[model samples]
Target: MRICFPVSQEKGWESPVFGHFGSAPAFVIVDTDSGQLEEVTNGDLHHAHGMCQPLKALGGRQVDGVAVGGIGMGALMKLQAQGITVYRAVEGTVKDNLAMLKEGKLPVFSSDWTCAGHGHAGGCAHR
Candidate 1:
C-alpha cells in the first residue's frame, strides 16, 4: 500500500510526521510493500486556513491513505471524497507511524476527530 505522511522535513523514513496535514513542510510517500519512498514539497503550505487542497500539496500523486496528527474538517472531507482513508498518526517519525499502521493501531479519522478550526499553526493536538 502507498501511504502518504505529512512531515516536517525531507528526511525520508526518518522524517517526523507533522502535526497538521495542511501546513506540513513536506510529505513522504512510502510504498510499504516495496520499501520505496519519495519526498515531495508541500506547494500549498502557505495557503489560508481551511483552504488546503491535499492533492495539490501532494503534487497530485495518488495515495491509498494519509497519516497525520490532525486535520481540519474541510481538508478531511476533501480527502474522504477522493476515496482516500485518513489515519491518526503517532507522535514519532514516519517509520514509527508506518509501523503503527501495519499493526492496526492507527485510528481511522472521522468527523469527530477533525479540528474545530484550521488546526494548530504547527500541527494539531493528538487525541
Candidate 2:
C-alpha cells in the first residue's frame, strides 16, 4: 500500500509531518511494499477556508491513504470520495508515521475527526 504524508519540508522520509493538510508545503508519498518515496510540492497550498484541492497537491500521483496531523471537513470528505483513506499522523517525522501506519497503530480519520477550522486548533495533537 502507498501512503501520503503532508510534510513541512521535502526531506523524503525524514521530513516532519505538517499540521494541516491544506496548507502543507509539500507531500511525501511512500510505497510501503517497495519502500520508494516521492516528494511533490503543494500547488494548491494556499486557498480559502474549505477550499482545499488535495488532488492538485497530489500532482497526478495515486495514493492509497493520507497520513495527516489535521484536515478540514471539506478536504477530508473529498479525499474519502476519491477512495483515499485518511489516517491520523503520528506525532513525528514522516518515517515515524509510516511505521505506525504499517503497524496499524494509527487511527483512521473520519469526518468527525476533522478540524473545526483551519490552523490545527481542535483536531490534531501535534501542530
TM for every model, in the order presented, reads: 0.92, 0.90
lDDT, model 2, position 94: 95
Q: For model 2, give the 10-residue run with minimal summed lDDT.
A: 118-127
For model 2, residues 1-127, the per-residue Cα lDDT tens digits are 8899999999987999988898888999999999999999998977877788999878878999999988988889989999999998866999999989889999999676677764345334322
Q: Report how far residue 81 has shifted in candidate 1, in Å.
A: 0.6
Encode model 1's per-residue lDDT on 1-127: one tens digit a residue: 8999999889888999988898899999999889999999998888887788999999999999999988988899999999999999988999999999999999998788787664345446534
Q: Give the C-alpha lDDT of model 2.
A: 0.86
Residue 26, candidate 1: how far off, in angstroms? 0.2
TM-score, candidate number 2: 0.90
Off by over 4 Å in 2: 119-127
